[model samples]
Target: MAETRIRIGIHQEVRHPYITHNLVGVTFSSLQVIHSPPTKMAETRIRIGILGCANIARKVSRAMLLSPNTTISAIGSRSLEKAIAFASENHFPESTKKYGSYEAVLDDPDVDAVYVPLPTSLHLRWAVLAAEKKKHVLLEKPVALDVGELDRILEACESSGVQFMDATMWMHHPRTAKMKEVLSDPHRFGQLKSVHSTFSYVGEGDFLQNDIRVNPSLDSLGVLGDAGWYSIRAILWAYDYELPKTVTAIGDPEYNESGVILSCGASLNWKENGKVATFYCSFYTNLTMDITVLGTKGSLRVHDFVIPFNENVGPFYAVANSRWKELSLGCEPEPSEFKITTVLPQEALMVQEFGRLVQGINGGEAKPEKKWPTISRKTQAVIDAVVASIKNGFKPVEVVY
Candidate 1:
């Protein structure tokens, strides 16, 4: 097939599904669809905007480029020069407009969706503003940095009839699906008794000084926000939506210096059945992400949670440990070990999946499932409990709702 020329500022009429006659705080009067093949003769595509020129934006923008149906229409930064420079350096040749502030991107009539990579503190403010502008939102992790804030943003999206997602990239990755499959083998693993997962990497000097990981208000919850979120999500998916009855956390008393819990260990007791699970997360350790699940019949161990492709660095897995650990108790365990098979980079898959979902909703192909909101809300509640546990001297905090 011949390549189609793609251009910016070319309004490709796109249709939205079962359009609401009216949405609160949002003017959908201009909502319409571009049925004609993109004018310059390119394939159908959605125009995306970025709220800032942060490094994470670099990854997301790259993923946008990878998607044939998405384009980086514009970018807004605190500085005009920085914005333009970022767009240019990132090779966003298609309608690469730059703005002096985030509001510019939010107000841009041509930008269909906005990717907000701002700090945790600014997530809700910018997300609500973007949604109000009738633009879909792809926000950075820890969605709101807190439960109250996340709830507010969620409310804004629902009220405005806008699509929004927390940029928890791994949630959209194919590896997670594969992980789920392996975890579902109840006959092989029997029952899940515990889950211990971790994610940590050394930070650059300046990053250590200013990273949100070290911000007190941002870390009010603890390392659970920084790394435990992924573990929680993974465990939940592994257990087929099974939730713990209670979750209690322990953090270093010097949480301020550590920002959030620089490190944390959590205990999760399953509801009704009383199955117990444990997790640990920290920012003050060498790079590592390993999750071990202890079951009645056997066990499953995943070496890396964030990115499984690093299997070369032992980012592999093991199963049925006793099969190989009979003679020596401390001997290395035996389990199924394999390498990543052409996995899509996490960020790229997330953007592509998000873009596809946004386009699907816009095209009336699918309804945004209720599960998304539940996942985000429940995740925040878990983090909230982590905070309570830390404040109460590692006391176990129960999971509510």
Candidate 2:
């Protein structure tokens, strides 16, 4: 058979002798052959607009830059000076636009999506507005003060036909996927029996009294919304987003003068499966983030589930079918550490994935994905239950959703 060659993008055409007559219509190159259109055609990269100059936005901005399919198109804040400073400090591209107000970024025709890193109280307003403007929204975690607020944001996104995702960076980490696989295996993990999660960080001096998280108006739920959000989401993820039957707030929650929670813990019970989970979140403890899942046949433990100690790789421990030694001094099968490495950090992967979805919509090949919003809703629902439990004198509150 005569060698066949096909050109894609600006790459030079190369002969593929191994490509058969049946593959003539397919695109081929010296290295490999792909049954698709030419690559030279310009593909749309999702242009992301940052809604605020919050501390978290700095990390996310770097992620957007690292993502191959996304770009930091613009950034806006109430103060133009702050926006300019944030952009400059984050090393935003020279071509990146800056605005005095978030609305301006939303109105920009070039911005295809918006990353809302605003305070929890402002999410409902800005997130909905971004959706109404036909821009995809990547909202920060603790998506809202309550499930109702989250529902409102979701409704707007659904009505406007745009994608919605919470900024749960760890969810996009390769280690998380691998951990899920292990937990789902029947022989390896059996049925999940219980789970315990904790996330906390000590807030010193001004942070304890003046940080937005402790400020009632800015973040009413306080540490529950900031730190507990991760713990609750981790538990929910382990249960595959299944709502528990009841949530009971653990003994006396510590609160600041403004009645904002500074520390709290909760227990979730799933009556149907007899599964139980507990989580503790605080802003007054040593920095720690842990998740331990126990199953009938195995167990898994992760010390840094929220932010990895190292960006290049995340480590987790897992053990199965253990037996005690003769003196009960140790176990027969010891836990082994597994490290999942990535070229880009989890946050960058998150931006890349969100951008990929937006690109699909831009190409008219697919609609916005619903999995993200669904998970976000479930997390918010659990949070609502926990809050209700605390409000009702630490009584158990049934999870309606």
Candidate 3:
């Protein structure tokens, strides 16, 4: 095979999924930055109040600062001192308020929106309350433990006419849009056939022993919520948010002593289109985040779908309509790599999008985008089906809308 007909991908600088690593907001790689086209910034920046001092907040706080249409107005933790320290350590503006209780931040009239990165158990309570308080909600993924809980949050936001968007950062990345465009093209990518995703990371020392993700009291969903959520979201995104007809737990899932899931896999069947999807998520495996989608004409593969190794550029490989060479030594038209560059990390883009939605609502210019909550509900619904299948000894559980 000719060298030009060979395919390869370069991956580097993988980081711990939970811990903070990349801090520089300006540059991503040695490659020159390719900026997005200029656009008008919102006239009014949304004031954001963060709930809890979770480690994830450290990265998101920086994102809010980088977003031109959003600002962190307050941060709250169980301990006022911790909140204050978090504010100081994260370099929040001096005027950003620190609250001892999450409710206090919700009560603050100045805060236009709240970013809820609290544990899964607390999402329903805090997210609903934020909506009732007229504060827009930017919720973390696994929006709720199940569809029932998610419905309540969505209902509250609908009742109050407040915007609700889950913090699935990768969905906001430019690369995601590019991939969607490719998959939607009938010529380049024919009918979608299958999607397989794997998201796992090694949890060393304190994480496995004390992390809320493994604690049933705080995050009963465990790795299913922490890492699996991303994989599930990716699968659903590739399927264009269509709910699977049935879901079956594929392998023997692992659980901690507390009965929290540590590792799991499931296969989903779409009856109408005859499409199938499978995903694996684990906390005990080597670091890997991959998503592969196959179609009649082409396939797309992304190694770092959950969190791109680089902050600025996201890369995916694709191959379409290939044929064997004369001697069948190798195929013609090797896979091509596509890179989408961004001025800010995907998290910052999420914050900016949320802020823009809130700004439009406040100005009476646009209504909330129902697509966000709709997709979130569908994701949780499939998760519920997967759990049920596992409990039923790997039986096929029908996904109820």
Candidate 4:
């Protein structure tokens, strides 16, 4: 058997008023053994194009550069000058192409995949178009305004035989995989009892009034689609994408004058197993991102689940068979904290994973992976159910898969 090893280098330089300048470099490597000989080795890197100049695209652009299996092939915007400026600001390679319109990027034969960071309303149109052009689609989260729209995008990808995956970076984090391993262990975690998640941030002044998230025509679902997406995804992931039987809006959701949701909460129930999940999302609260899962024998808690406070390391807490001390003053077994460190950030891992799948398809070794799009549909279905419940006077709405 032949062995293949990949090494990634991460460099960091810090300068502070109280301390002298410092420089640090770290190298991380992964090794895989292949039974096939060297003659069977195929190209692995996937060329990626960007469809918009959204702020979030900046982070993904960096990820594409950092990922060993991906590269920034091109960037497109409505205005040619804007695309040029974005490329320059992001320090894109001189060979990276710039187009005046997204269609041009999609038309480029060299582009094997595209990262769509367009608004939620435009997802159905642009994402479908990208797929129809036979370009793999890496879409931003809050995939669509509703399941119907998401279905259209998914159908296009399926018909075109292009891979489709929503950009949920945290799901690719090493810590997330570690946590899932613990949850799947029957002796350690037991049956799931309940899960609670919250993702919120205070947005005032211009953000509440002028941000695209609060605009009715832009991101109509607003915070529910923005911040709430992560919370809902966490619950679904913890339960392994099992669709809940019923979804009910917890209370009256606060909305802007244009009826854009600003803050909201929902409860999901699995009647068959008596499992319940609750989540709260807001654009009008102190910044907080948390997920707490309680099982019969163990509990797991993670803060900064969406975006880790420190990019290099992700931390989570877990405890099994914890017992109260005498007079309930303290606990007998303290919760243990686990940290997973990575040379690349979570977003880079996401791009690397996406690239691996695309490379497999390009090599004719496999078909497009369906796992990502399947989970994406399940998440959007729950979001749709919650929205229906909120519209129906906070009544319980059945989640009809």
Best by TM-score: 4
The alpha-carbon deviation from the true structure for residue 36 of candidate 3, after best TM-score superposition, in angstroms, is: 11
TM-score of 4: 0.90
lDDT tens per residue, model 2, 1-401:
11112223333322222222111122322222222322433365678999999899999999998876778889999999999999999999877889999999999988999999999999999999999999999999889999899999999999998999999999988778878977998877889989999999999989989988989998899999999999999999999988899999998999999999999999999997679999999988999999999999889999998989998778888878878998999875767667666767989989978987786776776788999999898888889998999889999999976
Q: Report the C-alpha lDDT of model 3 over 280-339, residue by residue, as the tens digit.
A: 999999999999999898888999988899998788887788789989999857777777
The deviation in Å at residue 205 for candidate 3 is: 1.2
Task: List residue ranges in candidate 1 displaced over 4 A.
Answer: 1-43, 217-222, 251-260, 309-315, 324-333
List residue ranges in candidate 2 displaced over 4 A.
1-42
Instruction: Sort all candidates by TM-score, best to worst.
Output: 4, 2, 3, 1
How well does model 1 score by local distance difference test? 0.68
TM-score of each: 0.82, 0.90, 0.89, 0.90
lDDT at residue 281 of model 4 (Cα atoms): 97
Cα lDDT of model 1 by residue, 319-393, tens digit: 543544566555444454533332346676677656666766666666554566678777777777777787788
- Residue 81 in model 3: shift from native, Å? 0.5
lDDT of each: 0.68, 0.86, 0.85, 0.86
User: After superposing candidate 3, which stretches have Cα over 4 Å from the reference?
Assistant: 1-42
